[model samples]
Target: MEKVRVLVVDDSALVRKLLSAMLDSDPGIEVVGVAADPLIARDKIKQLNPDVLTLDVEMPRMDGLTFLENLMRLRPMPVVMVSSLTERGAEVTLRALEIGAVDFFTKPSSDLANCFAESAQEICAKVKMAARTRPRPYTQVQKIDVPPRLSADAVLPRSQSPGTRGSTRIIAVGASTGGTEAIRVLLEAMPPDAPPIVITQHIPAAFSGPFATRMNNCSAMRVCEARDGQPIQPGHAYIAPGGEHLLVMWDGAKHVCRLHDGPQVNRHKPSVDVLFRSTAASIGAAAIGVLLTGMGDDGARGLLEMRENGAPTLVQDEASSVVWGMPGAAWKLGAADEKLPLEDIAARLLVLAQQPIAGARRAAS
Candidate 1:
């Protein structure tokens, strides 16, 4: 198999060298060349014709976002962003994703060598994943082999099910890879009075707040990062904080958000499994589970559990997904009751939320 070719673009010489060496360490990846800035990168792109481009969020001559917009419009291709672990970096990275970058990786603040050593696997994986994205002539899709991981049971036990339907219906969502933009699109389409939404989108801790803020600006419904013990209500959407699991818990009278600090489940801190399983056990038929575009099978089992418990489930169709790993896994497991494109999911969710729950399970006595 031909290795995925990559071009590294960063204004920092150290970063470019580190990124190139890290990407090349993977046998499946080949770093074709590196450029100091967007102008040089522009010329190299025409010369190298690399399958993927790892772009620095902040550049010297032209900013990453401006270059990304120009690239997407002029010569669409798969691009991954490299961002610093800061508030401004998070904000800029989110904008890059909205501008059509495939995914992003946050650089550590200090201890560069050690941090890069630990993150090399993830960095290479994102580049490989980007290679298979749309606008790049589709080569064979790369398979990501995830090692054994903790399940939702690690955070919240499976035995604890929310046996009764709450007073209000809830919408539970999970996504990764291209999820930031996907979640934005879905939220923007939701009406102000739509059911309460709980989301887990596989992001680093620094990015979640900015992501929520960006979503709030575009979405009609109020959106904010989920707070521990926060009341669940309609006309609002709660985003799971990065590095924490967001679960819906029964508080005897009503459902509320519970943030759990625990081991990474399904190789993700805010694993979709945790959120979906929490919804399945707590909300039962009164909830709708939507698995949007993401890589890996994190949410498949939990979505299946939701279906078994009578909740309606939807997976984003492959054509509309940046990476169909999560949704495809759910489709294969027969977890989703319906598969819809990104464009149709919001309307369908609204419709499903209105359907009355009949014979829904009650809280265990």
Candidate 2:
């Protein structure tokens, strides 16, 4: 088996060394070279032709984002960002992903050595995943025709039935790996009056806020990071805050978002499984569960539980997934009620959300 070649680019000599050691420890990966700045990294890329690149957000000669933009435009390849756990770092890291970077890792603020020690396995796994990913180029700006934005009331016209504004019907979505772009694409096409949406995207705490803001800017529905006790409402989407667990719970007669800090479930805080299982327990048949592009089976069992409880489950098809691990696992486990391409998921979800509670129950039965 051929090993995945990697190039590590960081202004910090310690970080570059630590990253190289961590990656080289894995038998499947080979540290091809290390660069102190983007200018050096650019030359090393042409010279080494590595399969993956671990890039620092703040380099000396040139910033990571600018180099990433140029790289994607000129020679697109898998690039994973190594960023600090700060607000500014989060914002810039998200921009790198939008510019076509494959994934990211957040460096710990304290105890750098201990942090790298703990994260060795994850770093190796992500690099392996990145090697398999083929990042799409963002060279030219393309104009898309967006429909006139509709309010929640307009999106979900009140039916004469019992499933009205306070309806427990909701949408639960989960993703990782190529998920940011996948989620953006899914949400951008949705009507403003769509059902309440709760999402779990594998991200760090600092990045989630900026990610939600970016999503909101492009999407018709109001998008924000999930807050503890925030009321779940139609025409609004809630994203699970990084480093916390986001669960939907029944608060009196209405459902509300609940955020809590807990031990990592399936190696993820704000895990997809945690959110999906909560939706299954709380809303059951009234909920629609979607598992999008990701690298692992984190949400598969929970999606199965949702299906068992009578919720409709959709998985993005392999053809459209950046990595088909999550959705593919769900399909293999018989957790998915339908397997659809990325483009079809939003429309299908809208149709399902429009069904009255009783009608949805009947269909499930």
Candidate 3:
């Protein structure tokens, strides 16, 4: 099998060396070259013609974002960002993803050597994933008309009341890789009174807060980072905070968000498996599970559990996904009740949310 070629660009000599060593250690990957700045990186790209690029957000000659914009415009290829675990880094990394970068890794603040040592597997895996990603071209901006908010009671099924103890329905969504944009497209299209949504998108600490804020600005439903013990309610979406696992649990008569600092599941802190498994256990037939565009099978088994519990489950179709690995795995496992395009997912979800939970499950089965 042909190895995936990689180019590492960073102003820090240590970071570049550490990254190269980590990536090269993997038999499936080869570090083609290293660049100290974007200017040098640009030249190396033309020369090496690498399959993937690992870019630093802050570099000497030119910033990563600016170079990324130019690269996407001129010669689009898969790129993964190397970012610091800071608020500013998080904000900038999100922008890079919007600009067509495939994925990202957050640098640890302390113990650089130990951090790289711990993240070696992750670094290699992302590079391989990046090589398989379909790079979409950056085109002219299009305007999206923000729809007006509707009452929660109006959008949901008459069989259940909104946030009435055990009477509410829940939606559990999981995504990674190209998930940020995939999620924005889905959420922005949803009606204001859609069922409460709980999401676990692979991201680093500090990034999930900003991500939720950004999603809230564009989405009809209120989006916020999940907090421990927060009540799940209609017309709202809770994003699992990064660096922790987010779970849904019954608190007396109400469903509430539970944050866990437990060991990473399937190599992810905020694993989709954790969220889907929790929902399957707590919400059962009262829930809808969605597995969106991502790079691995983290949520496949959890989604299967949801299906086995009589919950309707959906997976984004391969044609619309940036990386169809996650959804494909779920579909192969027979976990997906329906496979639909990205543009059609929200509308279908709205229809499902309006049906009696039991009826929906029966129909899906």
Candidate 4:
């Protein structure tokens, strides 16, 4: 098998060296060269013609985002951003993603060496996944090796009975990899009065609030990072805050949002499985489960549970997905009721939400 060639670009010599070492540790990856800044990276990219590029957000000669914009416009290829875990870093990194970068990871605020070493596995995995993706021109947009993972059972137990019925319907969404943009596109098309939407997108704690704010700016529905005990209501979308799992629970009168700061499920905090399973247990047939583009099978089992409980479930088709791992896994497991393109998902969701809950239950029966 051919090794995935990589170029490490960071202003810090230490960061570049650390990143290069991380990529080199993976047998499937080869670090072709290292650049201290985007100017050097530009030349190395031309010379090395690497399959993937690891870029830093801040650079001396040219900023990472500016270079990224140029690269996407001129010669689009997969690029993974290494950014800081700060409010400014989150804002800039989000812009890079919108400008067509494949994915991003935040560098630790302190103890750089130990933190980078600990996250080496995930860093290399993201590079490997980036190489396989077909990056688009100024259009937006993983961890590779599957280590032992804990399932939703780690946080929430599987419900033995069908979900309790509710008067109104809810939508459960899960995505990763290229999810930020996918979620944006889906939300942008929704009407102001759309059904309540609860989302789980793999993200770091600092980025979640900004991501929700960004989504709110684009979407007709009000989008905010979910709060514990918050009522689930129409015309609003709740985003699972980073580092915490978002779940739905019956509040006697209606379904309400619940946040769990528990162990990582499926190697992810705010895991898709936790949210989907919670929706399955709390709303049952009164909910719709939509699995979008992501790198792992985190949401597959939970989506299957939702389907088993008679909720309409759909996945973004491969052609429209940046990475099909999550949706593909769900489809292979017979979890989804339909596989639709990204352009059609919002319309289909609206239709499904309008369907009677009893009709969904009877169909499942």
Candidate 5:
């Protein structure tokens, strides 16, 4: 296969050299050009037409954000923002992601750091996959008109919803792409004692650490990345590491996490399917499964199997999704017992978790 062509842009010659060397070291990627600033980058965009562009946030001539806005407006392609690790930098990168940049990373501190950041292994992996994606024109998203905040009580689940069946006391969800903000809506409105929650959002190595920190600061529930052997406790939410799959195992009396690096399922290492399937297997008939906004069908079949194994499932309604790909695919397979708008999901899920499970099981039996 032809190598993925990359254009590296940074104001610093050292950063340019480091990025170019790092990307070119990978067998799957070839640095076609390097630009010292966005001014140079703009010229090369028309000439080289590289598959991906690695951009620095702070640069001479024009700032990266301004360049990115212009790039998306006139000629949109897949661009990865490279920013320093700062509170403000993170906030900017998150906005860039929402704006349509595919992904991001903090600029490594030095040449050695750059080498470690995109090791020969990861560079090859990311570039190859990125090259396959279609570069859509990045028209800025117009703010959609929304109705008044519907009271949380309006959307009730079907009789088969989780709380209606005793075993549904806990809810586990996984998502990617537009999930950061999506999860914030669902989690913030939820009460303090929401079901012991676990989630896996496909994200970058550096971003997940800060992402968890951000989520914890914003939501009422305690939120953090999962550690191996950490017991699955209620009122807390655990996110799996970005590049590893998180599996759940019952350790005698209590449930514990077993973070592993098994084969990638659904083209993702920290796969939603892996988490949901294991939850279905271990906590069968006792858990509620949720597959939310994402870019692909990563959780579709596993969610279906979860439903088949007697778990109730909820999927995000298409109207509220950023992409609607994952949930739409799951709904097409008839996996979701309930579909909800993003805002109401937390409220309805809480009701399901509180339903009397014993009575529902008695009826099922």
Candidate 6:
């Protein structure tokens, strides 16, 4: 097996030593070089051409974000950010994902021994994943710092069209990485009478409750972490809570969100696959499955199963995703029924609800 080459970039000499020692300890990984900052990294890149770069968010001479933006534009490759587990750290880390970093790890400040140990393992695994990711070329463009101004209908109204005909509709959404913000944006656009939405996002226990609370306040949809035996009612959004698998159970009369503590499928406890499989088996032809921004193939096959079972499924297009791994995998596997950019997804979703179940053809434009 070819060893994955990695370059470590950090301002702290101790961190450089620690990360170097940890990553180098992995038999599958080879530490190609080390650098203190982006300037030094640029030189090392020229010399070593490492397969992966583990970067510290805060470094002397320049912050990681600026360096990342420049690097992606000039020489795009796999870059995993090491961030502090703080509010500011999370915020910047989110920005790095959006800017095209392949993965991230919170620099363990509390238990240096355990954290660094875990980070080393995670870094090697991520480097392996990164080696397989075909990075897009860096492009220079002006930031649309301003979002398109949305209408009351676009931003605030319920998703149900006024005088809309009756159609059995269920929404299934999945995401990872910067999904918290993306979920907020997409759900907040719906009206009070929107169709029931189900979401499976990879999140931590510390964040999901707050994330659910945050979602409930933003959308008219009654968003909550799913519990066993909880009925899935119209005008509600059920989120698969962190650290548990969420599946759907249906009777001819109604459907319910079923939470389980089963072993993780595809290495994710609350997997997109488990949720999607249940959706396919129960909801069948009556659901709209969505594959959103994420970082793996966990949901791809399940979404295909959903499509085969008659649920029309959509994937987030590469142009809009933070990391297109999940959606791209689905598209490649012939699982996705359609692909749409992030901003247009909600608008198109309403149309999917109204379309006929038979002759399931996708209009990708």
Q: Pick the candidate with the highest lDDT.
A: 4
| Residues 1-365, model 4: lDDT tens digits | 89999998888888877777767877889889999988888999999999999999988989999999999999999999998999999999999999999899989867887777778777777888899999999600023345568999988898887654676889999999999999999999999999999999999999999999999999999999999999999999999999999999988777899999989999999899999999998888889999999998999999999999889999999998989999999999999999999989999999988877865445344
lDDT leaderboard ranking = 4, 1, 3, 2, 6, 5
The sequence of per-residue lDDT tens digits that candidate 1 reaches over residues 137-204 is 21232334555688888998884434646757899999998999899899999999999999999999
lDDT of 5 by residue, 1-365 (tens): 77788998888887777667667666667889999889999999899999988888888889888899889889887777777766567777776765667656565565555344434443444455545544445502222333333211122111233322234366778887667778777778766677888888887566667777877887889989888999887788888887777776666566777787665666566888888777766666677889898777888877886788777899998787766778989999999999999988888888878765534465345
Model 3, C-alpha of 335: deviation from truth (Å) = 0.7
Off by over 4 Å in 4: 139-148, 359-365
**TM-score: which is higher, 4 or 6?**
4
Q: What lDDT would each prediction earn against the true structure?
A: 0.90, 0.85, 0.85, 0.91, 0.73, 0.75
Measured on C-alpha atoms, candidate 6 has an lDDT of 0.75
lDDT of 6 by residue, 176-282 (tens): 75466568778888777788898998875544666687789889888998878888878889988878877776644577877877665676768888778777766
The 10 consecutive residues of candidate 3 with the worst lDDT sum are 150-159
Q: List the residue pairs that clash in candidate 2.
A: 152-193
Which 10-residue window of candidate 2 scores lowest in summed lDDT?
Answer: 150-159
How do all the candidates rank in terms of TM-score, highest first? Answer: 4, 1, 2, 3, 6, 5
Model 5 scores what on Cα lDDT?
A: 0.73
Give the Cα RMSD of candidate 2.
Answer: 10.0
Put down candidate 3 lDDT per residue, 91-206, tens digits, no spaces: 99999998999999989877887788777766777889889877887702112232332221121112221121244679999999899999999899987888999999998878
How much is 305 displaced in model 6, in angstroms? 1.6
Between candidates 3 and 5, the lDDT winner: 3
> What residue pairs clash in candidate 1, if any at all?
162-281, 162-282, 163-362
lDDT of 4 at 312: 92
